[model samples]
Target: MIDFSANMASLMLPDGRSVRGPICCEDDIRRVIGQVADAYGFRGFLVLAVPDTGCNSLEANAIMTTYPVEFLKGYDSAGLINGSPVIQRLRRSTIPFTYDAHQLARRRADGKGDAAICVFEQAGMPRGIYLPVHDAGGHRAAIAFGGDRPVVSNDEMQELNLWAGILFSKLVEVRERDRRGSGSLSRREVECLRWAAAGKTTSEMARILALSEYTVNHYLNRATRKLDSVNRVQTVAKAMRAGLIN
Candidate 1:
């Protein structure tokens, strides 16, 4: 666990910059979020773009995460996000809140099995807190810290809120900086890159977008070249770094 008092003391410098040092890249943000989560007694953290609608999967909007990949895959497959009380509350409320799997299961009316809740239990993260923030464009985003710990006190919540706000601000700053350096990507290209990053194949992307395989390849290839990447994998990395695709 981090020394919370010391961390707060180092949070700001004379000029208002982070005393945490320069966040030169996304990995820096991930590292900081992970370390902070552990200090707060959380086992995992996720930073994601909150969708305008509840229909989107977690994988589609995730910016950075310390959650298990297999759990993410299973959660997406379960298709319970739209029905999740946690997600619904997140969409409507700006205030941070704590949630548990049982509450999520009881509050949902979708008539689905407890697969999603079970997954959470199996992952050993039955409870967590969600802190909402926004990007430079005023788009809503959130940071979630999950663990089996007891509810945080008011003082702790206040500290976490300040940290989350500043962390997300730094994330937007870094992404904007990278985006300016990269060439512009078309909407179609961005769509293809997003799917690719989600682990979709060319054929799958084509089917999902109602385009031909040739067209999907065309868009992806163009995006790759525009980003000056050597291949699809590298293209995804570049697009992610540039914030072209979340």
Candidate 2:
């Protein structure tokens, strides 16, 4: 949702260098990402959406990366993001961490290893540092810089962490701005959807909100209609994506 062509006419980096010109298309975004990756001494980069609490599912369309397109397609086809050990670790830790492909392969719960890691290794990127970011509302995301070797220096890690955090914040701001442009959901609808997104049942939500079960279902059904979602789960997901509910 970033209007890169409008907002990113030029970007000034911390190093005092200017990244010039508007990002006119998807290829331009990729070029900008590649430039940023090179500036941080990385061969590839990824932006991943962190799932909401108690939700193991990741949004399929929420990923952006400078990795090989075919490899990314393969990873999606394999549905590896749901079981990604790197993302699981990031969810538990506050600080950025480095990971090797082998370590990730070994950490899979199924013990069969992840096809994404295998693809990354085959693509010559075996290790990387992951920088996690969370907003005040508990919306989580991560920016990862992948390379052929580990980033060993603590100072470098700290620097990259700061830069990545800033970049991710900007991206989040853009997404929120775009979401705000959509038709607004009412307060009760959002409240009900938030609880639904948190995995609460209609009866539980009714109890918590001090509303009748019928009223709770009404709010949810209204939200679902507004979001054009097929059901409660899809409604919650759409609401989250639109920043209408946390």
Cα TM-score per model: 0.70, 0.57
Q: Write the per-residue lDDT of candidate 1 for residues 156-242, one digit (tens) a residue.
A: 777778888878887787767756765877667788899999999978997898654645776677677778899999999988987
lDDT of 2 by residue, 48-102 (tens): 7776445543434235565655555566566676677776777787678888888
Best by lDDT: 1
True lDDT of residue 9, candidate 2: 31
- Sequence-dependent TM-score of model 1: 0.70
Off by over 4 Å in 1: 1-9, 12-21, 183-246
What lDDT would each prediction earn against the true structure? 0.76, 0.67
Q: In candidate 2, how many clashes are counted? A: 0
Measured with C-alpha atoms, the lDDT of residue 44 in candidate 1 is: 90
lDDT of 2: 0.67
Model 1 residue 209 distance off true place after TM-score fit, in angstroms: 31
Candidate 2 weakest ten by summed lDDT: 1-10
